[model samples]
Target: MTLIRLAIIALCMVFTAGPYAEESANLTDGGISVSDKNFPWQLVVDRGKILGCVYDNKFYSLGAILILESLPRKCELASDRNGIWEQLTEAELLLWQESIEEQQATKQEANYIGNDPINDEEARLIRYLRSAKKRADTQ
Candidate 1:
């Protein structure tokens, strides 16, 4: 019960607190909302399709798809919010998209700084594995 209220409040905050809130409208299709007029870029939210709160002006996912997909090796809500997605204003959506791009750029920069082939965790694991292999060969 309390959780339901909290979710509702959160969704309301997404809609009401922003400058473009008044212009936003719930889409006729339901569970989806869009902001078209007050802002230049249209922001769309399809609760049935996406899990993450951020939208890339392209596709919707739990987080930035590029960031989430870069893993080197491998591998929620209440009633009113159960299938409801949070809609961001044009400014907010642009900011989110920019941040994701920034992160991706930063990651790429790190990869090329010294021709470094591995991250800290990967380097640590490699070191351990090499040490283990050396010990086994000696035995």
Candidate 2:
């Protein structure tokens, strides 16, 4: 029950305090709450079959499919929120998107031979493998 409440609050914060929060689009814009099958823990917004993700640990994910899409409120609730979120510049956004694709592709090309590659926008996350960061930090 407590965990569920926390999740709900976090989701609400993503809707309220996200970068695009100032924009006209909100959670009510008609997207369904979903996490990618490859990356289930990654909270994603599915609108018309597209993805929207913004912000990540250490820095802003930058360069979403559109303008701004919140990753998770915890990404912004930090003290250096402005310093990080503000980094989502027009150029950086494109760079992030392109860089993510190229970087992940190169890393996987040796073993991956499929048309559909991986999307590591969520903390450079990979599919089917949970890392140290994904582990619970507290008791």
Task: Compare the candidates by TM-score and give the number of the best one.
Answer: 1
lDDT of 1 by residue, 1-139 (tens): 9567445544433433232222223112112223434532233334553333332233322221122222100002224433224344454444444544555555555444456566777766766886899999999
TM-score of each: 0.26, 0.24
User: Which candidate number would show the highest lDDT if scored against the true structure?
Assistant: 1
Candidate 2 lDDT, tens digit per residue, 27-128? 333232343245443433233222333332212222222233443222222243332233343443444444455545555663343755545453254432
User: How far off is residue 55 in model 1, in Å?
Assistant: 15
How big is the positional error of residue 103 in model 2, measured in Å on the Cα after superposition?
1.7
Lowest summed lDDT across 10 adjacent residues in model 1 is found at: 66-75
In model 2, what are the clashing residue pairs, if there are any? 63-93
Could you tell me the C-alpha RMSD of candidate 2 in Å? Answer: 15.7
RMSD of each: 15.7, 15.7
Clashing pairs in 1: 52-62
